[model samples]
Target: MTGGIQAQIERVRAELTSRPEGLQRHVGRVLTEALDLARAWDVDPDRVELATWGHDLFRAASPAELVTMARAAGVAVEAPDLAEPVLLHGPVAAAVLEARFAVSDDEVLAAVRDHTLGLSEMPMLAKVILLADKVEARKRQRAPVMKQIRRLARRDLDLALLCWADWKWVEERTHGWQSHAQHWHARAEWVRQHHGEVALPPRVPETADN
Candidate 1:
């Protein structure tokens, strides 16, 4: 952890102070999980801390607020993003972190950007933050299966991500909710890679925000 990164972490953490209490607590738990995973993965804890603090900067915003923020941050608002503005929170936060907060680390910004709906290929830091967010203490309590995912993450982050995506797929199907195209594409790639497939079957075009 360089002095600059530690400074960035504090700045991001300070920004998180004004968010809702529940969100702050959630971020706290995520920090705990992320730092542990960072150590296990031999990643820098300062970078993990910065991303964890910044990931949910806009989580508690209303849909209209999210959309407004997204536009202000220059985040593209796709159909899914307009329909579910919460999806833009990650991108919005990432943009703000760079433009406003001077967080210049590409991997750190990528971790914050992709934490909500993971990308097909992520830096190790992104993987740690994404898995940590999903398997935080409250989330594990809400979904018992998160315990298994959390355990798996310690050994295999990619496998844990695939399992979490599978669970998310089932969840959306059960609830009659639409799967975001970006995540669906990412999940498809993970499935293909996991099975060592060279090509994927034809599917709906990825045309929405994650």
Candidate 2:
């Protein structure tokens, strides 16, 4: 490689390393695979890995904190709705990446933006980012308590989202905290409709299911 390309690569790596959000160890590893997939599939490898890392920038921040930050940054999200928390990092993260790191890759930022929603006909990079977030360390403990999640994750993603729906239901009910339970329920239903074969949660009550 030429010195100019090597210099550019080092600059990008430095940006990745200096990120204060502190990427999880396995997230870093999965990005290696994400980059490999991006290469195999003819996508830009750097942008793919960058998008994967950029997806979780503000995850450690509370929803209120994100709303406050958003307000400060002029995004104008009102009252901290379920959508706000679900997409806390997405828009702002992309904007930050663009401003600070000059990440102009359309597809990379696109994947980062839609990482939470699992939008229609997800491409490989988007799926990779979502799965990376799913199997991440913060979610590891939530796994065993969720038998249906285990089954669904292993069997079918549509059902997996259903299990995730019920899991969030029980979790929110127990903790009595605000969650994106409704939005996730809707997303699960959407996936089930188009993707097919996902059953409603076995033990989830109808009230929570909705």
Candidate 3:
């Protein structure tokens, strides 16, 4: 890693200290998982660490605050983002990391920006950060299936992400919650890619064996 990148990492890590203690602990846990996955996937640990720390910088902010920050950061607040301003946290943090911290790595910025609602096309480092954020110790405790996803990520990051999206789909349906268009679109692409098909018909009645 270049000295400039190392300094950027340090600055972001220090910024994390001002966040809530719970959020800080969560970031630490994510760092542990991210670094481990980075080594396994041959991603740069420093970059992963930077993304992990910066991903949730505004997580504790209220929805109104997040909307304000997103607007100030020049992030487009779409209808979904207006409905659920918390979703703007990642984009806001990414903007701050770039404009404030001078972190110029596009991949790192994408990882932090898209960690909440993953994009269809992500670099390996983004995958590591996203998976690590989802499978951290507390998250695993909350959802036992995260343990399985974490294991699957070691072998197949793409498959693990597909599975996670599937689980989230079911979860949202069960709770009668609307799916964000961005995530729904990304999940659709992941499904098509996983099946190695294009523009496949919807599985109206899903079964164990399709």
Candidate 4:
């Protein structure tokens, strides 16, 4: 890592350590996962490291706070997002990182913005951070399917992404949570274009323990 990126990581770690344990653990896990995948994926380790550290900076903020931050950042807020403000954390965190920490790289900021709810044509670094966030060691403990995704990521990033999206879709359907329709459509399209009818692994049983 560059000296500058190392400094940024330290700054983020110092700030996050003072937050609640859940937030601290989440950020730590994402950072570790991102760094590990960076080498395999041939991405900039520094950028991935920075994005992971900053991605969840405002994850614990209240809905009203998220709205205020998003508006201040000039990010477009939708009605659904206003109703469920947690979804806005990615953009809000991206804005906050740039404003507060002097992280000006567009790719890094975009990765942070798209980490939670992925974009249709996300950058490779963005995909790495997003997938790392899902299959991080801590998260895999609770969601056994994440282990499979982690293994798949080592071989084929695109297929791993499709599986992650599929797993998320099934999870939302089972729990009756609102899902991001466009994100799924994009993942499906990307898989079809790249993989050409390759079969995805069977879904892990929801009731199974890791």
Best by lDDT: 1
Worst 10 residues of 2 by lDDT: 1-10
All candidates' lDDT scores? Answer: 0.93, 0.58, 0.92, 0.84
Looking at model 1, the pairs that clash are none
Stretches off by above 4 angstroms in model 4 are: 1-3, 195-210
Reference-based TM-score of each model? 0.91, 0.59, 0.91, 0.85
TM-score of 1: 0.91
In model 2, what is the error at residue 170, expressed in angstroms?
3.2
Question: Which residues of candidate 3, in runs, are more than 4 Å off?
Answer: 1-3, 197-210
What lDDT tens digits, residue by residue, belong to model 3 across residues 38-142?
A: 988999888888899899999999999999999899999999898889899999999999999998899999999999889888899999999999999999999
Order of candidates by lDDT, top first? Answer: 1, 3, 4, 2
Tell me how many residue pairs clash in candidate 4.
0
1-210 per-residue lDDT for model 1 (tens digits): 235877888888999999999999999999999999999999998889999999999999999999998888889999989988999989999999999889999999999999888999999999999999999999999999999999999998989999999999999999999999889999999998988743656456677762
> In candidate 2, which residue pairs clash?
none
Q: Considering summed lDDT, which 10 consecutive residues are worst modelled in model 3?
A: 197-206
lDDT of 2: 0.58
RMSD of 1: 8.1
Per-residue alpha-carbon lDDT of candidate 2 for residues 1-210, written as tens digits (9 for 90 to 100): 234433434555565565554565545755755565455556667556677777766656678777776666555464544355546666666666656556666666666766665554555566556544565544556575444443344444445554555566677679986545435556656556744534544545569547
Models, CA RMSD each: 8.1, 9.3, 6.9, 8.3
Residue pairs of candidate 3 with colliding backbone atoms: none
